[model samples]
Target: MRLVNTFAAAALATGLASAAFAQDPTKVGFIYVGPVGDFGWTYEHDQGRLAVIEEFGDAVETTFVESVPEGADAERVLRQMAQSGHDLIFTTSFGYMNQTMNVAKQFPDVKFEHATGYQRADNVSTYSARFYEGRHVIGLIAGGMTESNIVGYIGSFPIPEVIRGINSAYLAAKSVNPDVQFKVVWSNTWFDPALEADAAKTLIEQGADVLMQHTDSTAPMTIAEEEGIIAFGQASDQSSFGPNAQMTAIMDDWAPYYVSRVQAVMDGTWESTDTWGGIDSGMVAFADFSDKIPADLAEQAKAAADAIAAGELHPFTGPINKQDGSPWLAEGETADDGTLLGMNFYVEGIEGVIPN
Candidate 1:
């Protein structure tokens, strides 16, 4: 009877210990579109992941799979993360939108955040930074510094995000230098070094003295440096890759957002939300201008960036027209958020079809 009582008591103690140890650390997962060492888009996002690690040392555990392709592979990766007991997962690419949505339905308990996408669900959220604001500042610098009156732009896709950057850059450049023209080449990729380098060479051959890119690799920057032309960094600082060619960079700061979202999940306050943060919110920032840029031009760019952050100026405010000369924004009328989110056509003076 004593042995039986002791066994029951031990079993009760074991149950209590099991209950105590059942609270595991919150698990977070990240899916990257490119390698973390790309030193551009994926690099910036990996920094955010590191920030999450720093913020919550023992309370949270983070895992990442880099260079995960964006179709069926992405869906498989997301499902695997969910099955592994991940409390939160971030799909950091536009192509992962539908996949993210599909996975969210299966793992309704897991929180998912998709970057640069509009889709959302009860367990899914959307987030993006206003990179176009930074593009405008660089455009001004590119216009003032170009010697051949031509600025070459490298694009990843013809999506609204990339299109918005192109248009914003062109408008800012035109405002600064009336004779400046933009030569845009779509690489149809986010991170292909050979293709981006080839595009840069093609543009340089066609008389582009300044280079800009919406792609993620540093190939364009390297080409610009080798050719003695100035260029702007895409998602992160590429000055090391192009000491003299890098005039400035549009930095994506996702650390604060990532930490906050993770904390939200921990606090039981996480809800599906769409967050589009910009310069005003510190989501989009800039690297220091290169010494190659004239001091006056650098000052103007800084002042313009300040004006943008302070709401004193709007990049899309204007009398504008579509590619076919259709009236779009009237004089002094700023673009609405909805129109900008769905932007697909080039401005009146851009001189090209959107490549449906």
Candidate 2:
């Protein structure tokens, strides 16, 4: 009798599985590191999520959890989504690398996409934008406009992504003005508005006339506006936050990539791959130059943008040096994908260490 009952239970489970397969709505989920209302990195990614919903309509179902921490909570959230029958999941933060990997291992049948991570499994893929390209253009404008020759940088962490942006901005600034120096403050958190604002004020006190940031808030720009200094936006278009102070913005448009990934899943063609797109691919873009930027400088920035799009210029060209006065690249040489992938040191003109 017990064996018969066990067989009956197995049959019922199979029947439920078949019913769910028939009724499945192509579920996709996202996990965010910051509030969607931050109007920066998380906001841009959420915009992509919304685009997926609109593009797929009734054919797909989507949900997300915001303000997820990087460790155990992230693992729990991702596991819950997988157990709930989500077909695909996107973890949109650098810190989610290992958690995503672990979860992907557990749910081998489900697909996982992580941002800014190097690790990969058969079920896991990674994607990110070349944001520093946009930073180079705005750095030129900042260097041209600054009267003090000192630029303030608010950095979230010393990871390669943020470090790359800092070094790129410094290199571009020094290219236009040899006297320019960067003052950097490391907050160690991605979206702490209070810390970001404090860092901006401290840099201003240190005589920095221009501000740039790798953080995900409008607070630094707001402070710059109040103090009558100039700043650039990061991860999103933030001109509305500081019309007078914001010179230009680096905007991240993830909608196209999101739609393509979802369609691939629907077609059963999803595969693990790394995607790094810049201006030409429409993943990374620059907002219009603010009126605070001189007309000639804006023209120069636009020309650089066009050149990048046309493949006429490379940002990490040779004749570059490390902060320790060692040659990183020889003259007439450009950086290759391998070097940029593992960049961990500061370039010339940056003052601080790339914190661990």
Candidate 3:
């Protein structure tokens, strides 16, 4: 049910993909917050792990622990990986940030990569895709297609990443359909199917005809399919779960980065850095557009996505305002990375307070 775009495979064909095999297999470890079968965020990440194997073959031995809870459990798993001689470790969850750092301090030799976190250290790197870019495109489609103008957004958290997505998607929807309103319900957890399904039904009851989710499950998509409403897939393609409902999906192509980072460790050229790649870099790829989408609207969505890839369109361009209606960005000015990375407040027009 998951199709990694050809773009992702092409990106995975890195400089090291064809490199000569080294003597010892590089010991790479992965920590996941959800099961690989979730068919969403964790599924895509595990796919990246598989890509590392496909590209390097026996030159690298990759191991992963799935459904590992974030916090003491994550730290314990990480310490065990480090102690077991894992040269490189990827902690693939936002909640694993502090734990990754703490464990990195203990194992100075292990290279650590933390996803969707801002903090970095001498041996730790922070990397995340511009997921909001795809959100904006889907928002455009959702805006043009929704008959009720109510788009239900299931948010996993109120952090900058989630808040930024909510704003970007809303802004794009509002731009296309002025009456389009986002009804956001935070499930708070990243991969709870029951909770996600309940949130989707609640949104439908509140008059949402289109469902969008940031959580990592197909439950919402299943609900949308049964409700005969359209929705977008998260993290990976969930088209199988809702063939008619999924308009398109945003795929987080992590294979390329994983390969290159592992190659770095092998070559002893690894250095701590922060990487934020978007559509242009293939880090943010998309699934096939549904035939149900109008050709004209599909063209518009592609054009907008192309603009984002070309860096010509920033999703958060101003004349935007704070939720309080205070001016945040001047006309024609775009938001910088710092403000976007630390984004805390909701934009104007979104209702309800962000959960603490």
lDDT of each: 0.89, 0.87, 0.91
After best superposition, candidate 1 residue 319: deviation in angstroms? 0.7
Q: Estimate, for each residue in 84-166, the C-alpha lDDT of model 1 and write its tens digit.
A: 67899999999999999999999999999999999899999999999889988999998899889999999889999999999
TM-scores for every candidate against the unseen true structure: 0.94, 0.93, 0.93
Tens digits of lDDT, candidate 2, 1-356:
00111332343346764465565557788899999889899999999999999999867778788889899999998897787777999999999999999989999999999998889899999999988788888888888888999999999888888888888888888888999989889988998999899999999999999999999999999999999999988888787888888888899999999999999999999999999889999999877778767889899888988888888878888899988999999998988876787789999767777767
Between candidates 1 and 2, name the one with more favorable lDDT.
Answer: 1
Off by over 4 Å in 3: 1-22
Best-to-worst order by lDDT is 3, 1, 2
Once fitted onto the true fold, the runs of candidate 2 whose alpha carbons sit more than 4 angstroms away are: 1-23
Say which candidate scores most in lDDT: 3
Regions more than 4 Å wrong, model 1: 1-22
Error of 2 at 78 (Å): 0.7
